[model samples]
Target: MTELLSDQRIDEALQGLPEWRRVGDAIERSAELASFPQAIEVVNRVAERAEAANHHPDIDIRWRTVTFRLSTHSHGGITEKDIALAGEIDDVITDV
Candidate 1:
């Protein structure tokens, strides 16, 4: 089984992810795009990366804003996978 990350490690990892914050056992970030279609495009891009990594995040969309919450459900907490995917998601947000 994948091990859950320790609080210290998660904190350190989050240092580089300014837009993301710890929320209980998961980390979350929300991005606002110029239009609803652009927000959906970001979601679609994130979906591709998540599928490639075999990890997924819970997503919520509200018009031009999208919120992503990631956790390693199998481990019941955050893991390196979540951190890595967050970075990938950041990249997608930046690209779009």
Candidate 2:
């Protein structure tokens, strides 16, 4: 099984991911897009990245806003995978 990240490591990772926050065992980020279509586009892009990585995030979309909660479910906490995926998500959002 993948190991959980230490609190210090999680904090260090969050420094690079300013928009994401730790919530219990998961890390989450929410973005508000310019339009509903744009939000969906971001979600679709993130979905493709997530599938490619085989690490999925819990996504919530409301109107023009989308929230992503990522955790290594098998390990029951944040891991390197969550941090890496968060970076990928940020890139996708920035690109889209």
Candidate 3:
């Protein structure tokens, strides 16, 4: 199992991910797409990536806004996996 990230490490990771913020034991980011469909499209793309990474995030969709919350539940806190997936989510956003 992956180890949980330290607060210092989590802060460091968020430095590069301006869109994502540390929220308690998890990190979250919200994106506003062009339209509702566009938002769903991004979610679909994120879903694919999440599947590929085998690290699924909690997704909340409301109209054109989609929020993703990442946490390694099994590990009991945030971890490198969540950070890596956050980076991937950012990439997906720009690619969409």
- For candidate 2, write residues 1-38 as lDDT tens digits: 57899999999999999999999999999999999999
Residue 66 in candidate 1, Cα distance off native in Å = 0.1
Residue-wise lDDT of candidate 1 within 14-70, one digit each (tens)? 999999999999999999999999999999999999999999999999999999999
Error of 1 at 94 (Å): 0.4
Ranking according to lDDT, highest score first? 1, 2, 3
Q: Write the per-residue lDDT of candidate 3 for residues 31-70, one digit (tens) a residue.
A: 9999999999999999999999999999999999999999
TM-score of 2: 0.98
Selected candidate, larger lDDT, 1 vs 2: 1
TM-score per candidate, chains pooled? 0.98, 0.98, 0.97
Would you list the clashing residue pairs of candidate 2? none
lDDT of candidate model 1 versus the reference: 0.97
